[model samples]
Target: MISVTEAKQIIRANIRALPSSLVNLADAGNSVLAENIYAAVDIPAFDQSNVDGYAIRFSEKDITLDIDGEITAGSEIIKSLSKKKAIRIFTGAPAPEGADTIVMQENTAAANNTLTINDPALSKGMNLRPRGTDIRKDELALEEGTLLTPAAIGYLAAVGSAKVNIYRPPALTLIITGNELAQPGLPLRTGQVYDSGSFALKSALQLHGIRSPEILHCQDDPHELTLALRHALSESDMVILTGGVSVGEYDFVSQAAENCGVTKLFHRVKQRPGKPLYFGMKDDKPIFGLPGNPSSILTCMYVYVSLALNMYLHKKESLYQPAILKNAYRKTAGLTHFMKGMYNAGYVEILTGQESYRMSSFAKSNCLVILPETETEFKPGYQTQVHLL
Candidate 1:
């Protein structure tokens, strides 16, 4: 009976960020950092060359110098450059002691252990990467609460972080409840339909970078549903029940949750497609009883469950933004409508097959356009709220 915004607030108020754990940098991708990361050592660790060149103490233009020693990448040669002497160096190699300049190989010409600067524009420190230039030792590398992306991981590695403290993503259990549901790729018996909810929900989770969730199937019976709910709640930090949430005779998800000692936060929101969405909690675990319909489950997941999971990880939640409606839409229902929409170039168009059970339009859509409950008519070029997928 609550508005969508109020329902979201209630759901978030009960959630808390998960505990931090040490994870190898290799496995930290897409996880949020729980601690600030400081550079343990300067990047590059020492003065380095940025090009294949000769390292020499600059003095005068057009001066010939004697070749001292060669230093390639990862070499430990530490020969110092004397007056009018140069050391051959390759990219990433440490600059030899007493060397202050580098002239590109093309800018110098060598003849029989002697080198002459050919370019008049050669300057001191032109091709050198100074020590600690990229990052200083003990500097802040990444802030706390940063999302560990691939580039972030590489930066952490560059700063000598082998492991990091990150907030772990929640483990999930999916209880698919229905007797008439049949697995896909199998022949359907009488009064049976393919079980697309499980596949669709799994894909949705994967799309959001969540790992595969534990899946369980249950019939519509009350006792069986109650047992499945209990087991799922014990196994996961979050449980998603995909059916039997409504008040029909066979609907048992709500009753089962109550029987398992779950506190019902809310039963339904004033929204179409997913009006029967149910939310509850047992101990600290959050449980969602999503409507059985394909579009309804997906819509509720994106709107509510996604936010709950992000809150649990202490990550920033997604917010709605305005977009131009490309076409007109009219609705007489008093409930708020979340229409499947195709969005591009800051414009959105409502797609067909918006009924709760149908996912044809949902498959092609990239956003959901919100229509407020008070007003129902939308015209071309109308600005409305949009939640991008």
Candidate 2:
């Protein structure tokens, strides 16, 4: 068994990033950029009106002017304003040639073919979006390693980028190993339990921009589990096995993985709920054999698994957020405890249930409070570390 820090270090040292791929903007969801993006063309492309009103030369604002034909958004034609004239224009319509300002329709009165400027406070360039004002052509838009958020994707689209280069997330396969597990919504036989790890693991993977990883289920038989491991290694860049990693007589994940030619990096970690976690590698691919308990699998995913995935994308993030303890807590010595807890702005309170099989408190908690193995006594107002869910 190894400490949590050592487990993380070993996992990181064994994995490497997958190659970057050019993906369509539509498919890029909160992914990290592999390359710097530059604006392909000026935003707005032309001076355009931001309001529904009139486009006019600023010098002509003080006098009544004749209204020319209107300009609507997406129109291919541009009209030039004659001296002492204004053109009716709507939002997103290009400013007519020889025009420098837009007057809001709400601020002016118009009748017949002429217009009258209303109350003051109008200035030059008012309501007019200048060409290239948002981003000039060929300017750096987003740097490499930036997260492709919704706004970032929209901004890239504005600059005419249909696709981008992003460090690829792995193709993952999940191998569920158990004979006593029954699918949800089905009648359970005696000594059987409903499987929760599959749903929890899939949802957590989705949060990292990974969707719909292939799932394979097998019984505890040695041959069947080995075949599952072999198939997962063949089809996926990473494999996660839930259940059957412990020393139980029925547990066969470790043996099956070894039979499938997977080199074991470590078999246990010195943490609560997930102590029997197994990590291994085959060639360049990484494999994780997580404890069967619902809470343990999720916690291991957040800590050990996240480190490996981020390393595969050339990304780094802090693992803990500091908070002040709201209540004193005590625990047995010799094992580090990752207790489910509630975290607010700057404070945290450990909840009641911390058992591996119980998820009631896990459901209510937003973080995993870290209690060191050496420190057994915690007092209120003491500084603590938490991993936010």
Candidate 3:
């Protein structure tokens, strides 16, 4: 078995980034940019008022002025400010020519066309939003490969881009395999249990912005599993199968994938609950066979599948952050273990159960306690790596 890092590197190297598509800015949230976004025009476009005030030329003393015209948002004032004069301007109005400063209405006393500058101790350009203050024409406002966040969307809109080039979302499929599994709300036989892994995996994928994954449930029949694998490979860019990866007699997912012309990348990793994890590729489509247990399925998804997707999309890989161990965490030294835990304020507390089948502890976990293979035991206050969920 190879280490988790080695397996991840293999998966990352094999996956290819999806193609780009032109999408509206409103729909580009959480998508990766495919091209450099250049500013079409200067932000603010023109010198405008930053405050609702009188546009005036700053003078040495308090000067009496006549209001020539009024300018509000979206209105044009062709008049200019002359000496000892001002224009009534609202916020976002273009600054009239010859006006060098804006004295807020609170600082000026006005009656009809006459106005008195109560205090003219302001400097020029005091409240003018200069053209290109936020962005300049032809400037690269956003770089290629950037993950578009809400702020990026607003920025793109401000720069007058109605549409942006972003990477297309990958097509995904999920295959759940097990003979002892049944759907929720259905009566279970004497030894059968409800299939919780599929639901959990589906929910996790949804949280990561993946919806509408084609799901296939195959019992412990090799022919049925092979057929499901073939169908998934034909339609999806990536396929994730949960269960039937271990060495048991009934375990046949790996075999089925191989029979369907999938090239196995690796079958096991030096990890605790997810040791039997499998990664493969068939006709350029990535495939993963995750451990059947609920906790194992979710853990492998977060660590392996999520990383592969991010890498394939050309986004930055999420790394395990360093944190201090809140309490002494002990473990064996051979295998690299990803333990469910809660992290806060620079510390992480490992959850009680590390078993693969345990779902209760996994439900309460908000982070993973990363135990390196070299560390046998950890004392309180010891620093460790943590992967936040």
**Best-matching candidate per TM-score:** 2
Candidates 2 and 3, the one with greater TM-score? 2
Worst lDDT 10-window in candidate 1: 203-212
| Lowest lDDT 10-residue stretch of candidate 2 | 310-319
Per model, state how many residue pairs clash: 0, 0, 0
Model 3 RMSD in Å is 2.2
Query: CA shift at 181, candidate 2, in angstroms?
Result: 0.4
Candidate 1 local accuracy as lDDT?
0.88
* lDDT for position 88 in model 2: 91
> Which candidate number maximizes lDDT?
2
What lDDT tens digits, residue by residue, belong to model 1 across residues 1-389?
Answer: 87888789989888877788899999888888999999999987999999998998877446788998799998876667787788999999999888888889998889999998887788877888999999999999999999988899999999999999988778899999889999988998999999998888898787455678899999989999898888888888899999898889999988999999999999989998799999998989999999999899999998999899888777777667789999998998678899999888889999988898888899899899999877878999998988988
How close to the true structure is residue 98 of candidate 3, measured as C-alpha lDDT? 84
- Selected candidate, larger TM-score, 1 vs 2: 2
The local lDDT score (0 to 100) that residue 147 gets in candidate 3 is 83
- Minimum summed lDDT over a 10-residue window in model 3 is located at 58-67
**Candidate 3 has which clashing residue pairs, if any?**
none
Clashes of 2: 0
Candidate 3 residues lying further than 4 Å off, grouped into runs, are: 76-79, 182-192
Can you give the lDDT of residue 304 in candidate 3? 93
